[model samples]
Target: MELALSLGDTPKPFSLLDHHSGSQQQKMKDLGFCMGLGSTRNLEDLHIKNMMREKDDEKVISCSSSSDPSSSPPPLPLQLDLLPFSPVLKSPPPPPPPSLSHRPFPWLSKNLIVESGSQSKLVKVIDAKPLTTVSDGEELAAGEYSSPNNSNSGTSSFQMDFSSIFNGGRSFNSRKRDLELSVNLELVDATERDHRACSRGGGGMSDEDENGLTRKKLRLTKEQSAFLEDSFKEHNTLNPKQKQALAKQLNLRPRQVEVWFQNRRARTKLKQTEVDCEYLKRCCETLTEENRRLQKELQELRALKTNQPYYMQMPATTLTMCPSCERVATTTTSTTTTSPCQQAPPTGSHGL
Candidate 1:
């Protein structure tokens, strides 16, 4: 009985199973998961997946908060020293450009002569200068294109080449005596071609005087004049081809034909102007005659208007002398006497 009671306090197999099973199950749950839902990842993969999820959540929060522009501070500047080790990148200093005098180019590119495979210069400016020669001057003016450095040759290679212009030649801004290299260098060559030679090229201008000048033809032949007149009737102006054809047919030069046509046009214009002047004169005379006639008519009308009452009062019959007052008087009717003074002769004896 005692043994049974002691054992009763101690675990029985059936009761032990119940408590142990429950406790073991709780312990197992605390320790690790049970059968997975459907995961295919290992510990490392699952940890990575969890980290990615957390990063996505953080990104979502950041994006949502980013709407308030003032809320976010600017991103911190990247410190180069803090960055990973690299080739320690740095820009190299630029190489100096080649100078003009050191390697001379063609003075005039048009005159470049290619012999076999190499190029040679037909004409070039003197490289040497008056002072320490070209070498000293080149060193002083050695610059990338044009620079502040000025030498005896000028500013740049261009100024140096054209030193004959502003610096070498006569300029308003005169330089020091030692700097003037081009005192009186001629810029333009004299024209050697003769004007008479050009004039002698025409076919009709073959006749020359002792002075080597072509003789002027003052008159044209009757046949030539007639032909030119017919041509003038056809067209006032002539094209180059037509002029050439006309010259060939008339045994004349193109210049002569052209001048003749120009003269003919001038004459025609003058004749037309004269005819117009004559017509205008005739019109003026006709207008003057009409104006005179109209003026006479107007004068007659004005005089008739001024003397209208006289015509109404008097008749064109006869004139008489008044015996009473000795004054001339007019009558209205042709049958009445001309003299009829208003004053009665002694009033009572007026009828006598």
Candidate 2:
């Protein structure tokens, strides 16, 4: 369970707008050192209180003018009266102090890199002042920022300038791409081989001894390999007993198995997301091409339909000559006359 509370109960930034001097004249700025990103409701409460005080003052002024001087009761004492105020001499008021706890720059992440493996493998940003460092010279190493108790990396609490991590000719983006390619390739290859091996039945020894006992060579430490192989075989969430059994088989602690499962789930999800994204991309391209082709076809059809030639009346048929009688046929009955070859039936036919 992740808790949102910070160590030191620092009062969140409370903006005291001097309504007396100017309302919009003063710029609002964040105040106070961040224990984390921004202070909690404690800071919000103070802001509300200040706003109420200003509203009360405004109400007092408005009510006072409308009241009868003779019968109206004395003005109520204001909460602002109890608060101390220093009189400014002749100097211009100091620039509105920047809010130390203003909503952190929107683009910046509130998380500190607790453990940046090939990817940001394990991240915990519980503190308010989320482990930011000044300038670009102090980027923390891969193992320098987790809890001190972590067995893998002993010293885990180091302040580092995150910007420096992206510096030195090679950018974080490039490094991230390289890391992604490496992890992705490793995971894909492992998964594919494991799938292929498992689908081919148990990838163990084939031959048997004289006693009919088959000797199998171990590919990994008994426990470690079993844990991995079992993970590939099984589906659904593992219970404590199953986890322990798996851990024992793989020669690892239960915690290591749990973490491995967690990381594996994350990696699989990421890969799936990438695949889904690629599929969507291809789908979009196909749709776009189809749309373009349809549009072209529609345009061509439209042009063909719109640019059709106007209909013209056909001329009356007039035969210029007759083949059988060798005379011009003035009327349009050219089919009524025929040559001897056309009029004669075949020799086998009986035509009188």
Candidate 3:
């Protein structure tokens, strides 16, 4: 027989075993059951105390068995060391609420009629006239205002307040408009300064001596020059955005950046032309030397032909006749005095 005990508000039924033949064992089991009830309340208190202490401790469940079943049960004084089992209690932390900032605006995603509640509308600032007091019907006809928080109806019957539409907060659009206006003012100022400089002959000196005009030269910093060189190496051309970005980075006007790029490209083309001219000069020199060598070889060949021996130029035959026999003979003065045809026959013997 066995008994299970728990230290909670509700007491669960104990698992019963088969009937035991021994009366002493049965009596012992009954006594254990009765003793469990008395210690239940005390166990509950000890469990509460352990829970407070173990709040920050590692999560674990410890269990033990009695060494001697025949021995009597321990006293009702609750001691953790004597306990056989312990149940761990844990409470999970609550989940956080979903954030609206990270959520995508459904109207913008689907290209639907944009509601005022859309966060994208809060960030996007377009130049437009401010809303004026108008009838609800006219406002609905304009189709410029709609609130997601109010009604799903296409037309609103109430006069929509600007403050309420902007959620009672300062509209980012106003600040954005002010920033754009400041940038435009800066651009205008820069243009006016450029015009004044041009009028004062700041670019270059006049050709006529009567008008003594001199240009103002802009010297770029070494760092700025190096950055521009690197950018040029990456790409020789610049779009408007790149020009603007470079101008902002170098603290120069956009026109200045554009002019610098133009001058740099011209310099590159001029250097390439000089290099090509030098290459052509070298090629001309090499061709001249080769032509001179070929002409000298041709002249040597002509001299050899003119200085050839007279005997080498003559024909091999020199006709002669034997005096005693009156026989015709042919001989070459360069080889032998007597012809082979004449020597083969007797000197006095002749066909005549």
Candidate 4:
């Protein structure tokens, strides 16, 4: 709005226009305009605006223009669309990246700027550097870029080299994870079997390990058992120190050695007792057979002696009759035998 002073000689033009409004400055920046101060006349003209008074009317005071019409500034363009010159005047902006915390992986680039000589510059700013990984894979953030005239149309490109800091980590981590999972699976399987056994019979696990392969008892190798057997042959018993030494040599536990010695001693004693019992039984049977043969021979001798008659005796022997018995009696002969009256029945009355 223009205001004119009613001086007695001539009228002067004054204005209450703001030189740089917020919207005007924003539009100027969008158009890639350089912001600078104006001339002294323009500054004086800007400060000449009078503040409104309570009784002043809100109406324009008309005044005539200056002598130079060509010096006046042209009006601002009313219709300015960024469509036709969009490709040349303004370059497409670099896509806005997420914050470090929200990103899937760490990206340590601080700021990415793609600048073109003929077109507008595209800028993408990152707030903070990304965090380091657990393995201490510290990414090296560099801002080494060059704008070549011919290449990329004078655009600046950034390059990064994720060198040996993350080297050998992938294979090591994968193998370690596999081993841990295997151990965990074994433990889990054993636990599950124990739970099942307990649930079925209302009892805890036994020495058989619930028939699980992971719970089977350890068996000594052939070499280990052979060494153990030789040691046992040397001495059937073992002291604590000796057992420890043997166990260390065999790569086994002292308890296992001690148990083996105990079992070996028991088995040896059992075998010896069995041998002695078998020998005694055979000897008893032999003696019984010998006694039976001797008894049979004695019975045959007694029968032969009783059946011999007085006439079958030698000529030197005599026969006589006693007054108490009517039967004939034989005298002592060269052979020793029982008398007919002993171990024999009496003769019939007709024969006497």
TM-score of each: 0.30, 0.26, 0.29, 0.28
Question: lDDT of all the models against the reference?
Answer: 0.32, 0.30, 0.35, 0.34
State the local distance difference test value for candidate 4: 0.34
lDDT of 4 by residue, 166-255 (tens): 111222232234323433343344334434433443211111233332433444433345446645544456766566555433434465
Q: Candidate 2, residues 1-352: lDDT per residue as tens digits?
A: 0001111112332222212123221211111111111112233322222122110111110101111111113223111111111111123222322221111111011122333554333122322221212122221221123324445223222222222211121122432343344333443443344334333332211112334355332132222343253343332245665565444323234554566667655564455345434543554465467569979999997687667643123233454433322233344333343323334555532221
**Best first by lDDT, ranked:** 3, 4, 1, 2
Position 89, candidate 2: lDDT: 18
RMSD, every candidate, angstroms: 56.6, 36.4, 49.4, 62.9
Model 2 segments beyond 4 Å from truth? 1-226, 309-352
Residue range 205-320, candidate 1, lDDT tens digits: 22333343655343453435655665554455677766765554443456667899999877765554454345435544654675699799999987996878776565554444
Relative to the unseen true structure, what is the Cα RMSD of model 2?
Answer: 36.4
Residue-pair clashes per prediction, in order, are 0, 16, 0, 0
Error of 2 at 226 (Å): 6.4
For candidate 3, write residues 1-352 as lDDT tens digits: 1123322221222211111225532443322221121112223332211121211211111111221122223222111112111111123312222221122211111112234654222221221222212234323222233223435223332221222111222222332343234333333443344344334443111111223343355355333464465455434566776766555434345556777788876675555345434543554465467569979999997687678766467767665544432233566656645433345657564332
> Candidate 1, which segments miss by more than 4 Å at Cα?
1-207, 310-352
- The residue ranges of model 4 lying beyond 4 angstroms of the native Cα positions read 1-215, 309-352
Return the top candidate by TM-score: 1
Ranking by TM-score: 1, 3, 4, 2
Task: Show the colliding residue pairs in model 1.
Answer: none
Model number with the top lDDT: 3
